[model samples]
Target: MKWESDPEDFSPSATIVPFDPPLPLLRAPMKAGLGDRPSAGSFVLAFKDAASWRSAFRATESKILEQCELAELAGFSLARQ
Candidate 1:
């Protein structure tokens, strides 16, 4: 989750807006297989076609499962405290 190198005047046609085409490298390797504890939260979302990039990756996995179910129902209503 930390690969930087993409600036050099980074011209994706000066900031992507209507630039349709050039984003296809979906790597999938973090399922408890690279350092074992990081299960998710890695990121990247670029789109223009393929059905709006699969509906923007299912609306970003349904908004990260609706914000982890509203932060586990606000931490179970503050642990019923």
Candidate 2:
């Protein structure tokens, strides 16, 4: 997938509710091994504590639903490790 450098493209549409220990958004650099498709890329969100982790997870879940409703996404499934 193409990654946009424009901050506006990644901005959340809804106002994020403030939570304790405020979850800071982390964007990891994308990398690939030999033979990997150039279009394949991924980013990770790292949390410093459980509170931040849970807060981000819930926000992500809610965002996915909102995107689907807006036709920006077809569907999504959660896979917890």
Candidate 3:
């Protein structure tokens, strides 16, 4: 699994949502290790807090899983609000 755990090293895939927008976004990265076919990638989701994070996860859970073309959900994580 290619885990990009370091936020600093993830700048290329990083983006921020300004607080002026009211609900700023947080970053959640997911790795999909697709078998041994060299089909792996990262998914970046932004939210303001854990609640929003979970909401986003739920929103994408079925849609992402149904596709199942990007390997697997692998896992997801977040920083503090």
Candidate 4:
């Protein structure tokens, strides 16, 4: 399955690690890293079926758009500050 993340929310401290087991595995960190620092705990995603994989991709797309909106709002807020 394909994976995506929001650029605005991305942190250098975050890491995306993919593993191939009986199924495909993808993991992301829960927090951002300091410059060049490694990530800590990871959130994991496992895909065992085609339908589920497609669903995950769609969800990621929606999430990206949502994140963009949030980032825009945050930027506007910061500018006002």
Q: For residues 4-79, could you state the per-residue lDDT of candidate 4 as single tens digits?
A: 7576446654655666677445442334435333443333234556776787899899999999999999999999
TM-score of each: 0.27, 0.33, 0.26, 0.37
Per-candidate RMSD, Å? 20.1, 17.8, 22.5, 22.9
Which prediction has more favorable TM-score, 2 or 3?
2
Determine which window of 10 residues in candidate 1 has minimal summed lDDT.
27-36
**Inter-residue clash pairs, candidate 3:** 26-47
Top of the candidates by lDDT: 1
Clash pairs (backbone) in predicted model 4: 13-33
By summed lDDT, the worst window of 10 consecutive residues in model 3 runs over: 72-81
Point out the higher-scoring one by lDDT: 2 or 4.
4
Superposition TM-score, candidate 4 onto the true structure: 0.37
Q: Give lDDT: candidate 2, residue 18.
A: 64
- Give the CA lDDT, 0 to 100, for residue 41 in model 1: 42
> What ranking of all candidate models by TM-score puts the best one first?
4, 2, 1, 3
- Per-candidate total of colliding backbone pairs: 0, 0, 1, 1
Score residue 12 of candidate 3 by CA lDDT.
50
**Candidate 1, residues 1-81: lDDT per residue as tens digits?**
345756754677766678479765543333244544454545324344577668778989999999999999999999998
Runs with alpha carbons beyond 4 Å of true place in candidate 4: 1-46
Q: List candidate 3 stretches off by more than 4 Å.
A: 1-46, 69-81
Candidate 1: misplaced stretches above 4 Å?
Answer: 1-52
> For residues 23-58, what per-residue lDDT tens digits would candidate 3 score against the true structure?
544565544345423433454334547888798788
